[model samples]
Structure formats: C-alpha cells, structure tokens
Target: MGWFSKDIQTMDDLFVHQLQDIYYAEQQILKALPGMIDKATDPQLKQAFEDHRKQTETHITRLQAVFRMHGAAVKGQDCPAIDGIIEEAEEVAGEVEDKRVLDAALIAAAQAVEHYEMTRYGTLVAWARQLGRPDCAAELEKTLKEEQAADEKLTDIAVSAVNRKAA
Candidate 1:
C-alpha cells in the first residue's frame, strides 16, 4: 500500500507506515553496503562503509525494539525511494572507470541514503510524540542521531579526501 493509503487515516497509522518504510530502507542499506565496501577505492571510505554496515545492523535491531514497544509487528513495507537511490548508486558507480571518482560517487550516494533516513526518523520521532508514545520517540531519537552522525561523517570523508581525489 502507498504511504497515504486508506488504512493510514490516523496519526498512529502514519507513524506505523513510516516505521515500516524506514525498516525496509535500512534493510536495503544493509544489502547495498557490502557492494559499496567492495567498490570503494579509498581505505577510509571502505572502512567507513564497513563501520556503517555494523551500525546499520544496530539500527535494525533498535528498530525491531521500537516495533515491539509500539505494539507493531517487526516487518517492512517496500520503499521505492530507497530502491531508487540504491539503483542510482549502482548505475553511477558502474559507469565510473576511475576508482577515486567511484569513491566520491559512493560517498555521495551514501549521504543521499542518510539524508532520506534522517528525514524519516525525524518525522517518526515527532509523530511518536504526537501519539503520546514518549518511549517510542526516545528510542527513535537514538537512531535519528546516528543517522545524522553518519551523514556528517560521510561529508567529512568527502570533503577531507574523497572529493579531492576525485577532482
């Protein structure tokens, strides 16, 4: 079902839909990271992907916990946005012959994923508060902070090294 489908008539429905969306997105990230790690030319970029893969695992677990707390089943809805992002990353990375430029592309792609996640988690936190589920909101806040930090780290990696190498 689409995000705004008939079932999601209440704030709680919206919150659950978002939670499922991010859960699916996180799984997609997990699947994509291994390829990104393999393709990254920069040692730091490779390490960052690897580290974030682990963090993504933690994020998934935390999401499951949140699902439990929210009294929802631990399952994911299909997220076309994330699928498109991953597909674009793969296509762009495939076209780049230069490994350094590929690294730069990878960082950009990763940051795109991070930004999408940040938006989702931020909205979820707000909705959780509106739903009077402060406990769920607090749990989601941890993931939001992590997503923000990951985005910043990717920016740092891009600015400090990847962009210059690509240039």
Candidate 2:
C-alpha cells in the first residue's frame, strides 16, 4: 500500500506503516549486500560488507520482534528511499570501470544506507521508548548500534584505503 493510504489515518497507524517500510527496506538491503561485497576490491571493504550482510539479517529479525511487540502484523510496504539508494548504487557501480573507484562509490553508497538506517532506528527507538514499549526500544537499539558501527567501519575503510585508492 502507498504511504498515504486511507487505512493509515492515525499517528499510530502511520508509525506501524513506517515500521513496515523500514523492515522491507532492511530485507531489500540484505539481498543487495552480497552484490556490494562482490563489487568491492578492497579486502577491508569486502569484509565489512560481508559482516554487515550478516548483521542486516539480525536486523530483520529484531524488526520482526518489534512488530510483534507493537501488536502490528508483519508486513512490508514499499520504501522509495531504499529503492533509490540501491538504484543509484547500481548505476554508479556499473559506470565506474576502475575497481578502486567502484569500491569507493560502493562504500559511499553503503554508508548512505547506514546513515538512513541510523536515523530511522533512532527515531523509532525514541518513539518506542516514549510509548512505554521498552521491549521495542531495546530491539531497535540493537540494530541502531550495529548501523552506527557499520558507518564507522565504512569511514575507517574509506580513509584507510578505499578513498585513497580511488584517488
């Protein structure tokens, strides 16, 4: 369903719909990470992608748990943000023939996704906690930490090699 569907009239309904949107985005990302891993030439970048691929799986699991806690059914609505990110990554990665350049672009794009996830989870956590759903907050916190760490790892890799190599 669309973001503004009549079914999601209340703030609570909107929040649940947003939750499903991110949940679906996480699942789409889980599918895309392997391609990023394969495209990356730097070992650090490769390993980071591999690690995040695993973490994204756990993130999906945690999101599902949060849904259950919220008493919302497990369902996913289309998320244009993630779709655009992935599409942009594919276009850039395809155009950059140089392996190093591809790796750099991949890292930048992946970090964009991490940043998006961090913001979403942070808001979700605050809302969950404010709504007196500590369980949901805790679950979101787990994914948020992982997202932050992933962003850090990407930064470290970019500074250490990916960015330098691309230049």
Predicted structure 2: lDDT: 0.89
lDDT of 2 by residue, 1-167 (tens): 55387987776776787799899999999999989988888999999999999999999988888899899999898999999999998999999999989998998899989988998899888878777888888889988998999999999999988898899
In lDDT terms, which candidate is top?
1
Report the number of the highest-TM-score candidate: 1
Query: Backbone collision count in every prediction?
Result: 0, 0
- Candidate 2 is scored at a TM of 0.95
lDDT of each: 0.93, 0.89
Clashes of 2: 0
In model 1, the clashing pairs are none
Off by over 4 Å in 2: 1-3
